[model samples]
Target: MEHDTSLITTIAAGFGLALILGFIAERLKIPALVGYLLAGIAMGPSTPGFVADVDIASQLSEIGVMLLMFGVGLHFSLDDLLAVKRIALPGAVVQMGLATGLGMLIASWWGWDFGTGLVFGLSLSCASTVVLLKALESRGILETMNGRIAVGWLVVEDLATVLILVLLPSFAGILGGTVAPTEETVPLWRTIGQTLLEVSAFIALMLIGGRRILPWLLWQVASIGSRELFTLSVIAAAISVAYSAAALFNVSFALGAFFAGMVMRESEFSHRAAQESLPLRDAFSVLFFVSVGMLFDPQILMEKPMHVLSVVAIIIVGKSIAAMGLVLTFRYPLNTALVVAASLAQIGEFSFILAGLGMSLGLLSSEGMDLVLAGALISIALNPFVFAAVNPIINWVLQRSELARRLEHREDPFAELPLTTERKYLEGQVVLVGYGRVGRRIARELDKRKIPYVVAEQNRELVEDLRKKGVAAVSGNAADPAVLIQAHIAGAAMLVIATPETLNVRQIAEIARTLNSDIEIVLRTHSEDESQFLQKEKIGTVFFGEEELAKGMTNHILQRFAP
Candidate 1:
């Protein structure tokens, strides 16, 4: 009369232990995922306690990946992704290559064959999207420029990994893995072609068809006025689209769910959907870490501690250095370089998947998989500490090293405006800080009215494009008085702080006031507390985002009825 309840038991045990350990971890000043992963390791088969169903746990983890990625999609705009392409695209590609090379070199030293080493190298190359999203959100930087760059870099790496996933199976035979059946032996070139075609088709379908259909579906469901149904619709869209993409087009579940969220972002109710999906994402993300811990064999640590150490070095130190160099080469600020470096000092879900796949295809040995898993566990657990150390590390280096200061203040061609700038732009023009969405709109209006403006933006590529268009722009943070002076702020009639709230508005205001006491200052902020602080300081005319939005909507309603 009784049936096995393995699924129920797994959930109960996973959650119960996760909460206790998670609490303990937080109290110890560590990320709670460290606790969740510890909970999994305890319940794993290797530890000889109560081992949960690996199969069920894995499925639950997959759901976590879907939800977490979908949540990111809700906040992440396509424009954000495109905006960082200049740095993210090349930075990811080069960093991955360097990481992969380091991995392969170490593997070869351990007597691994080329096929095994290649798989081993690849497994070390990519960082976890799940870990990154959670880290950024917790730190309240998910919408910041650094966060955008990190997310965009990971997205590009994920795309490249997907391609490798496709082509890896096809090249298994050639790479010294199991050969394909004689009847199904398609040429490598055709496999490459088909894989690209399929990936492209999937992207096109999501961008064109998914974008149009998803928002309409949300509207239809919202009109019904049922909260539960709206939540159900969002969850269904995330899981279903992710499942379908993997089933029909060979895209990764994370990518598919990400697209689903991006499309859902088009709906007016996106904030609601993100809130509704929050609990599930948080709970299942804990389960995801637990499952990852389950895959790790504790013996691997004892047996091949040095190999594990080597792999960790490549992931945490080697890859991070490579990424930092690449970013600095692109002329980003020193702090941006440090943050991104710290961001990538770890590996996660994709590494496990890649190692597992390689094992199945006979391209990797048990030792290889064990090594990758060990590196992942250690690096992921240590990633939070790495992030926490960024500011301290920067300060430590700057205090000790003259070269570091020089690099931080290095000259970029676009850092100064051209000598050909008209006098109108130099004197009594708008000194706009940040050339992002709001600033662009203001610049467009100024252009129409023939009011000259000099833009100060941190992104050098944006400045380059602006200059190419014959617009006056300087490439550096306006927080520096030198950057402001480069923009000729002394002669400017107004200082418009249209940047993200990451800047120290007070410092900028003081700098502008000192440079030109008559200049009017304007500012924008995302936080109510900060807005009040700024207003109290009388730093400028503060525009709190949500307050302004509410006022605009309220005024529109009033106007609609008055006429």
Candidate 2:
């Protein structure tokens, strides 16, 4: 007997093409997302190939969306946002406004209605969180100060987008579009008020009840000691909460899943949850991109090339300029401004979601959706190159303009130590780089042992605190030769780099070696492969955190079983 195999065929074809093209993309030094999108295009009806069922692909995509948001929530840190709130909050809001305004102007030029312009503009405002994080991670800067600010800025944008998703349906009539007409149209204020109330109630429930129940549920499942069961529980919680929120409270699935992951973060099992669920989350995420590909009409590129270019400019140029201006206005260093701007110069998953919602509500036309997708494809494809160009661009500008050089070299009193007769602590001492978690512990142990050491930290506040406590400290990136000079690396006995910035470790090591050829060097890394490479190059004593932890645990167990 023959059986219906449409679902199986769709899954097989989607994953197969995605795998092949994704590998090719990586080999070509591009993000695998580009490959996934290409795969989807190949299987889409627009490409005249084996078209997967759009409806089935869409359902799978929804699951992917929920899982993707869940993973994001797991990594979301309130502390990180609060750390950069002074810059992130206002910067995100202002930058988003500028991008939106540009988008609206372009839409108006194209003769679209105000509602369509609003939706299109909002879609162009936010950067893709996935793409940004990946870029930062690859560069080993995700833990840097600028990275934190960028992540925090994106969080603000995400929250704003969630609010828009909630209120869009309510204001559908006023926006000059309606998915479905109501018996009597509700006043705009009334609709907004109702949405706020329901959202508040749902948020309260998640924070208050979910905080207690979800952890308890995970704890119970974990006690069963079954990995499969634990993974199932995580998936279930994400999907159930997301579906219930939409069904009962009229909240978006993305918002619901985000909250679920946030609440789950309070659990001791949060790391395990993230680790186990990653494979599944990643699988679904690919499907989500694939489904997005299916919706694109490639003729938009040929039919409206100028419109596409305008949208791309809004995303890449307009948004970037706004972010850079905001960061500079906040008195951040030019390096920080450049990094943040580069990070936000691409659009991704959230843009697609907003476009789809607008289209469903009749607030955005097919042409608008196509333009958004086209803009996303081009911008995402170019983001890495944009980041790669930041340093070169900054260098070129500095060399050409004295004003640029002055701005880049502007002194921060807090970040520089005055040269004086206090020279005793700067000689024959350990120069410890970074003042973060690992550096702090090392400092404390040295203090307890009465060892002379000087801290070279990037955070001015941290350096100030160290000095107040009578510890020798200088503030600036260790990778800077001047900062190393300030730390008296030439006279120092050793250099201990406690930061996990893999990309800069080699530079710091080389600088220290150049200054003091016989200085003992120690470094830390998160990747075993990186550690092996460093060790092979004789870059100094290297430590991989996980490997060290395993060794320590083994010693403890061996001691327990001692003969």
Candidate 3:
């Protein structure tokens, strides 16, 4: 009559410890994720007492991954990925290569074999999508341009990792893995082509069929007015698609769930679906962090202190510096570079998964795996501090380094309006800052009424496109007084701040006011508190939240520009 209660005990202990420690972490102004990891470590075998089943904990964490990715998909669309592809795609690929190279260097220095070095290096290359998502969401910047770029970059990393996971098994012998050697050479390109085919098929199906069917299904279920059923349906779709994708298409569970969520987003009730499923998503996500913590063997830190430090340095310092440099090279601003770098500083689920595969293939020793786990734990715990340092570091660099200031505010060929710009746009016109969704809408409204405007956008590429289309736009952060002057703010009838970039909006507004005392100003904000603060400071007309805010801002600008 006896039965195993391992699952129940694992969840109970994990959640209980996570809650207590997480609360303490928050009270101490630390990230709750660090607390969750600590909770896992407490219940792990290495800690000695009442060890939770690591296998069961890992499975539970997978469910969390499925849900967390699904939620991200509900918000992230294909267009969002496309929006940052110019930066994210190249940035992720180059940064991963750099991290891998660094990993290989460290491995070689430690006298590891080539195969072991390759696997170890790759294990450090990818950033955890879950961790990046959590960081962006907590900062209330998940919908911003920078957030999209970071998430898109991680998406590319995940895709690349999935390809590596698939191909690594085929090259097991060459990589010194456990697979027995055969006379036949491993068909490397064949396997890669097959993987691409399967991946393409899965995506096509999700985009074409799943998009139509899932939304319809959600609609049918919601029409029934059963909250329980709707929630069940959403979770069922997430796990089912994830499992099926793994079984049928050789896709990662997280990627499968993400596609499922994206498809479901086409439905009218996508927001409701996200709302109803949040509790489960959050709960499972905690378990994911806990399970990650459980895998750590703290002994590695003590046994090979220098080795552990080296791994941490490669992951936190080496990878971050490389990624930041890549971002800057791509012509992204300093803040984007710093944020992207901070986002890449921690390795998570994929590292553990890759290391496990390495062990099975005999390419990595248990010692190497231990080092990876140690690095993951320490880096993840410190990731919050790294992110917190971004703004301060940016400020410090800008103030202290001439080169850094140029990187922050540099504008060149497209920084100034061309000499041929119409006099109407240079004077008695609206200075439109940002060309994102709100900015686009404002521009369209102005175009309809023939109200001349010039755009000041941080994205140089966007500005280039705008210019090609005969729009008067300058590329640079508006917080730079020179950028404002370039936009002819002194003669501008009104200034419309449309993008929610993390720049000094107040400073930009003050500069605009200083340049043109008679100019009117309008600003868009996502936070009500920020809107209130802006209004109190008389920093133009501040609109808060969503499309309505955009509409109101557009209407106000139109009224001022009315003939």
Better of 2 and 3 by lDDT: 2
lDDT minimum window of 10 residues, candidate 1: 179-188
Q: Write the per-residue lDDT of candidate 1 for residues 191-222, one digit (tens) a residue.
A: 76776787789889988999889998999999
Q: Which regions of candidate 3 fall more than 4 Å away from where they truly are?
A: 133-148, 179-193, 333-335, 360-362, 395-400, 501-503, 544-563
Instruction: Tell me which residue pairs clash in candidate 1.
Output: none
CA error at residue 544 for candidate 2, angstroms: 4.0
**How would you encode candidate 3's per-residue C-alpha lDDT over 1-563 as one tens digit per residue?**
99999999999999999999999988876667778888998999889888999999989988987887788778876676677788989989988998999999989999999999999999999888767888888876676667878998988887688678766766776566676555136576775677778888999999899999999999999999999999999999999999999999978787799889989999999999999999999899899889877877788888899999999999999998998898888777788888888999999878877887788789989789888888887888788889999999999889899999888764578888899998999989999988888899999999999999999986677788889999999987788899999999999999999887634788988899999999999988877777778789888887778656679899999999999
Error of 1 at 329 (Å): 2.3
Candidate 3 weakest lDDT stretch, 10 residues: 179-188
For residues 1-563, write the lDDT of model 2, one tens digit per residue: 99988778878988999999999988877788988888888888888868999889989999998999899899888876766777888889888888988999999998998999999999999899989999998887889978888999999998888788888888888888874556146667888888889999999999999999999999999999999999999999999999999999989898899999999999999999999999999999999999898888899999999999999988999999889988887666788889999999999999988998999898999889889999988999999999999999999998899877766766766555556526766788899998778998998999899888888877665666677877788877888898898888999999999986777899999999999998999989999899899999999999999999999999999999999
Better of 1 and 3 by TM-score: 1
Total clashes for model 3? 2
Measured by lDDT, the strongest candidate is 2
Cα deviation of 167 in candidate 1 (Å)? 3.1
Give candidate 2 misplaced runs (Cα > 4 Å). Answer: 1-4, 418-431, 443-455, 459-474, 485-495, 506-522, 527-543, 561-563
Ranking by TM-score: 1, 3, 2
